[model samples]
Target: MGRTTWFDDDGLKKGEWTAEEDRMLVAYINEYGLGDWRAMPKRAGLQRCGKSCRLRWLNYLRPGIKRGKFTPQEEEDIIKFHSLLGNRWAAIAKQMPNRTDNDIKNHWNSCLKKRLFRSGIDPVTHEPVVNVKATSSSTMSSPTLTPSSSTTDSSTSSARLLNRLAAGISSRKHGLDRIKNMILSEPRQAVKEDKLMISSKEDEEEEVNGCFMEIDDNLISTTSLDELLCEPYDMYQSDLGHEIDDQLDLFLEIHSLGQDLS
Candidate 1:
């Protein structure tokens, strides 16, 4: 069946309605109740179309219609509901008792949508917008340093080991930055990835320490008692060498216990 046209052949009134037209619409609805809107203008002596009349009555002249600015709670709920339901304004209106779908939609487009964008949030997805450039720049600026050359001398090797330790700290800092980006961009995935990264790093540390323990035990056990006694006196000659000896001792002690367990 063809849909009945509510608009008149000569075109019904299109602009702002007069006070008399408002009164007539209210009077007609009150006396006869809201019947078929298509035939309403003719019966009520109104020049407006059925759609216009319906909108005017529902949005403006309807009882209990809160016409003022929306409250903070209503604004919050609209954003929350819109995130869950998308553009289902009618469904959103159901939760807001005094609001219409049109008002809710207008408020979102005019206000909430822009607000979300400004706050780095994707209105459609309701997720934080990741700044790719920021992440890239941060990572590029903090390049991980590597040992420039290899040497068999114990002093040079110790210096390289210290450099590698510093590099490891830098790598962990980068890892933390990536985690921060993930959290902002995708929270649920970030949580899972965070757990996995922590566990993997822990396991890596254990394996690395196991290897270090074996190396440390071999180095300590192979050294002559005379070298051990002389090394401390040699370390005392310079502050830098003293620091190196102290660090090496601490590192070996920590890993030596791990060797016993193996």
Candidate 2:
């Protein structure tokens, strides 16, 4: 036997719901409360499907529904929750009080993804998105899980090396404090290097043109030797002559060391 449809020919007024239909629905539900949603449209004199009416009332016409742009904090919470929950928008929305699942999904697709990309995060993976310093697409994928077992092995080894370096530094030791200071000083050191490079280049150009510009050795510090060695760092060695092999080695070592320590 064929399943009978709930909607009757005489039951429906057969068009979009009017103000009268909405009022009737509101009055009926207020008096009787919602029961058997498939039977609601006929009982309440609405033209729309019972499913459609229920959705419209719950999502759009609900008394305490909030309809507006999400605040920055709300957006951040949504992103954090989404990173953990992975598209369970309904569950996330429930925590957001008046916000709907549809709203959250649209915001993620249209806005949040761009924000994540701008902040150097992989929107899909929710991990720090780094530029590939190497040429191969293999380098584009995460070092932890690659098609090449050798690559994975190398990555693991590199992580161990980094952990050793980290373990070598103790909080009570002056060496650890020195390293922390060095790390914090890196940006300032970079800016100083840029200024020195620019000044040196300008002086060289002036000298070649039979003019003189004052050169100052005091402008460049001898203290930041490591940072100076890695000056003008860019992905794929755009500024410096960073080799693809070197880049791969660096990444593998870093990843391996990280894993080892953890």
Candidate 3:
């Protein structure tokens, strides 16, 4: 919308109003009440348009209008409403007590939009941004799951919706598994390629069987570390069977590579 004309070639007062103007508008409304906005300015003794007078009364001079910073709960409600109702500011205002449509719209535009963006969310769609800090396609962006994951729209049947939801999750999980398998398919090579050159310098200083041994003593002490291990977290180093270990390695590889899971 273009800037609201305070005056249209008719020389009627436009733009910002004076203290006396507000006083006159408020006084007139207090006495006659709000009805005919086109005639209100004339009766209110103001040179402004009826639209201006009405807006000033309702948005500012009106009683019960919320002023100052929005509370946490109010901000949350605004976000929720925006996500569901889009940019329908008046509709969002109905959900919030004392908050006018203009105020909510202003707040969303000035504050919430920036806040959402900084938190890695697209304020318009209200979805998590996917590796968005990078501007180029070659930046290796990760995919983010969003409400659009489902194939069906809002008009879809319950069974179709459920199937789409299941399908979306399955597709994501399968993609992750494929990447994982690719990395861990050469489990031996991956382990072998990790060129960590440990030597006798790392041997534990302990008297084993009353004899101060070296590498053998280190091996004996290494076995004790396995007792400290637990499932999932320690799975890589623990004695999961060959097949289970391979799967676990695959999962960890995918996870380490930053493949998103739904």
Q: How close is candidate 2 to the true structure, as a TM-score?
A: 0.44
lDDT of each: 0.53, 0.47, 0.51
Models sorted by lDDT, best on top: 1, 3, 2
Instruction: Show where candidate 2 strays beyond 4 Å.
Output: 1-21, 132-262
How close is each model in CA RMSD to the real structure? 24.5, 21.7, 22.6
Instruction: Point out the higher-scoring one by TM-score: 1 or 3.
Output: 3
Per-structure clash totals for the candidates: 0, 9, 1
The Cα error of candidate 3 at residue 133, in Å, is: 6.8
User: Per-candidate TM vs. native?
Assistant: 0.48, 0.44, 0.51
TM-score leader: 3
Give the alpha carbon lDDT tens digit for every residue of 143-252 in model 1.
21111221223332333233222222223433424423433454333222211001122233322222232234433334433454354435433523333343345445
Q: Can you tell me which runs of candidate 1 are displaced by over 4 Å?
A: 1-9, 132-262
